[model samples]
Target: MYHYTAIQWIFFFYFYCFFGWCFESTYVSLKSRKLVNRGFCRGPFLPLYGSGAIMMLVVSMPFQDNLVLVYIAGCIGATVLEYVTGVTMEALFKVRYWDYSKNKFNFQGHICLGSSLAWGGLTILMTEFIHKPIEHLVLSIPDSILTPVTLVLTALIGADFALSFKAALDLRDVLE
Candidate 1:
């Protein structure tokens, strides 16, 4: 059994989210032939699947002893997250990048292989491995540094998303 402090967990969440975003970006770029933002424009918001997986695993922290159950639970969480991202993005953006409405093995939407892999891998790592051991490693840091680091990282991600969105819109404008 492993244990981590509050700060470590926050750092882990940050790391997982960043890694998940990059992994999702690469996957979408390879599978959909577009970057993360482009994929968001051309396909469903699959990155949320990984983020959702992380959320699920975090929520289930108390029950990390069961690997199989954790993975299954994470998958369910990922599915719901996928749908939420899809619905929310549609409502917000007024367009859907991909349609899984008619596809087999899909529940009113598509969950691509890349997203699945990201979710599954994250589910395993977060639940079975990193949860407890890393807390000690991060807890030594001052609160001031931690707070600002998280804020800066979050802002950077937001900025990246905005830039990507602009580029995607520009491409759409050119195509039209």
Candidate 2:
């Protein structure tokens, strides 16, 4: 029943990316006793989190009345996304961003049951409490500014992803 325009979706993506980055960095910083930019992109964003949120938002649209189903779907969807992203990143970057090997019920340290359940619980919270207000806020922006902002943000995100990937691929120094 909730329909979002493309521009609204773009804003949602950016909003979630920055929010995820903040959540991740702060959590890591507290754990390490030092600040950390805990995101794949060099910018203050995390595409994986953003993509995961968007995917769940879309997937859970039909299950609005069924919170339990939404939560279960989120568990599976986020776990798959996390696993695939972990495999692809390790293969491409030759770096492990995260490892859950110490955790119980982890699959190749890529997807863990704890994290999956957390994702599901968060999905329920987001779908039930957060997303509607966010959608309203995003769509409230006037078209005159929304289009330009979305376009600019999209370009910046694209460039950030490319540059970060390029940095990860920099193995010449190691080879030497």
Candidate 3:
């Protein structure tokens, strides 16, 4: 079991958010043959990824020794989060950021079997491979530096989310 300070957890979340954005943007840009900032926020962050990473960590805590259990837990947890997020975002913005309507075994275009299975694999990869180095790096940082950095990042991301939320609402009005 890994223990982290609140600041450390926050830092991990932000790091994963940026990482997710990079991965997503690159994939999207390659597919479209153009530069595309992929995420709800204008900044290089994806709240869904951050939240999913955190959820994976939390859900896999008890079953860390058993990869199969970890996979199951991740599938259930991530799918629920994805579904709820998709539903809420569509309701608020009048647009679907992701739609699995065409995918086989999708529920309300929000969650799908393939995505859920992939989430399970991602959870195992994250817990077994990705997090160790990140954990070490975060642990090495002194509180004096980490605290102030986290505070600044929190403020910046909060502002970005607020702006993005407002823009989404405005877009919803236009769509309506």
lDDT of 2 by residue, 62-167 (tens): 8888999999988888888889999998888777788999999999998899999999998888787878788778778898999998899999999998888887
Residue range 22-103, candidate 3, lDDT tens digits = 9999999999999999999999999999999999999999999999999999999999999999999999999999999999
TM-score of each: 0.60, 0.93, 0.98
Candidate with best lDDT = 3
Per-residue lDDT tens digits of candidate 1, residues 17-115?
A: 555556767876899876644344223233443366457656566557777666666666676677787777666555676677665556556565455
Ranking of all predicted structures according to lDDT, beginning with the best and ending with the worst? 3, 2, 1
Q: Give the TM-score of candidate 1.
A: 0.60
- Model 3 clash pairs? none
Question: Lowest lDDT 10-mer window, candidate 1?
Answer: 41-50
lDDT of model 3 at position 5: 90
Q: Which stretches of candidate 3 lie over 4 Å from their true place?
A: none
Determine which window of 10 residues in candidate 3 has minimal summed lDDT: 129-138
**lDDT per model, in order?**
0.61, 0.86, 0.95
Clashing pairs in 2: none
Best of the two (1, 2) by lDDT? 2
Estimate the overall C-alpha local distance difference test score of candidate 1: 0.61
